[model samples]
Target: MIETLAKLVSTKIKTGVTQKELGARINMKQPQIAKIERMHTLPSFSTLTRYAAALDLSIKMTVESIIK
Candidate 1:
């Protein structure tokens, strides 16, 4: 799931924005964005949300009860 999200962010960034630009939008550093794009480190949920928002994307999570 995380890799998927990271890939999405990376793809959007490739559309013209640089990692540094994204970092500025999210108040992060270019290296941090690079790490995320490369999946070298896992980003926190809030960080992922911020990343998505900066790219004009949205994230939705659903939890369902498990019954045996």
Candidate 2:
């Protein structure tokens, strides 16, 4: 789950917005975002919810998609 989300947040998708931008939007610190993106920080329940909202994805859908 963590890895997939990180992959989705690669530099390629960092054009219109970067990790720092998204982190600010979600009220998470840049380091927190980086750690999450690097699979170093496991997201909390609320963090996951916020991430889904920010990425415009349903938590269930996002999680299910990463079930591999």
Candidate 3:
């Protein structure tokens, strides 16, 4: 989960959006965004949503049972 989140953030950052700009949109600091992108910390669900929004992305979650 953490790796996936980091990849998503990195992809967004590659699209010409600086971490500082993204943080400004989400009311966070660049270091906080860096931590998230580096997988140094995991954000809460709400914070994840805010990150997605700031990156002009949306998150979709689905649950499946391991047992058939």
Candidate 4:
């Protein structure tokens, strides 16, 4: 799930924004953003929310019932 979210963020960043630009928006370093985009490090929930907000996006989560 995290990997998927990372991929989505990466793709959106590539669309019209650079990593450095995004980092600045989120008060993070470019390398750190790169690490997150590449999935080298998993971003904390707070960081994820910040990232999404930086891109004017939102994060949504869904839960599935295995018992079903």
Candidate 5:
């Protein structure tokens, strides 16, 4: 899940928004964005929402029972 989130962030960043710019939009810093993008850190739910908003994206979560 974290890896997928990281990939999502990377894809958004590749859409012409630099880490620094995205961070500025989210009131964070480039290093923090880098850490999240590199999967070195996992952001909280609120932070994740902020990232999505900054990139004009949305998050959708689904859960399934593994025991099924």
Candidate 6:
């Protein structure tokens, strides 16, 4: 889930939004979000929920697929 979210984050970055701004939208600390995207850390379920919401994706179903 973090990996897919990171891909979207890369898209957001290319579109000119900073990590700080992206983190703000998802209510995460910038460094926390950064670590997840860099694959240095895994995000919690709630955090992934927030990220999925922020990224306009289906959290439950999609992640079940990912986990499987």
Q: CA lDDT, every prediction? A: 0.82, 0.70, 0.81, 0.80, 0.83, 0.73
Score candidate 3 by lDDT. 0.81
Q: Best-fitting candidate, measured by TM-score?
A: 3
> How well does each candidate superpose onto the true structure, as a TM-score?
0.78, 0.65, 0.83, 0.78, 0.78, 0.62
Report the error of model 3 at residue 21, Å: 0.1
How displaced is residue 50 in candidate 5, in Å?
A: 0.9
Off by over 4 Å in 5: none
lDDT of 5 by residue, 1-68 (tens): 67557666776858988889989999999999899887788788788888888878777788889995
Residue pairs clashing in model 1 are none
The residue-by-residue lDDT of candidate 6 on 1-68, one tens digit each, is: 75667666766777777778879998778898889778788777777777666756645543345564
Q: Which candidate number maximizes lDDT?
A: 5
Summing lDDT over every window of 10 consecutive residues in candidate 4, give the lowest-scoring window: 4-13
Worst 10 residues of 6 by lDDT: 59-68
Candidate 1 segments exceeding 4 Å error: 65-68
Model 2 over residues 1-68: C-alpha lDDT tens digits? 75547545753275466778788879988899889877797877678768767767545543356566
Reference-based lDDT, residue 28, model 5? 99
Q: Please list the residue runs of candidate 3 whose C-alpha ends up more than 4 Å from where it truly belongs after superposition.
A: none
Better of 1 and 5 by lDDT: 5
Pull out the clashing pairs in model 4: none
Worst 10 residues of 5 by lDDT: 1-10
CA deviation > 4 Å runs, candidate 2: 3-15, 61-68
lDDT of 4: 0.80
Model 6: CA > 4 A from native: 62-68
Error of 6 at 1 (Å): 3.1
Distance from true location, Cα of 15 in model 5, Å? 1.3
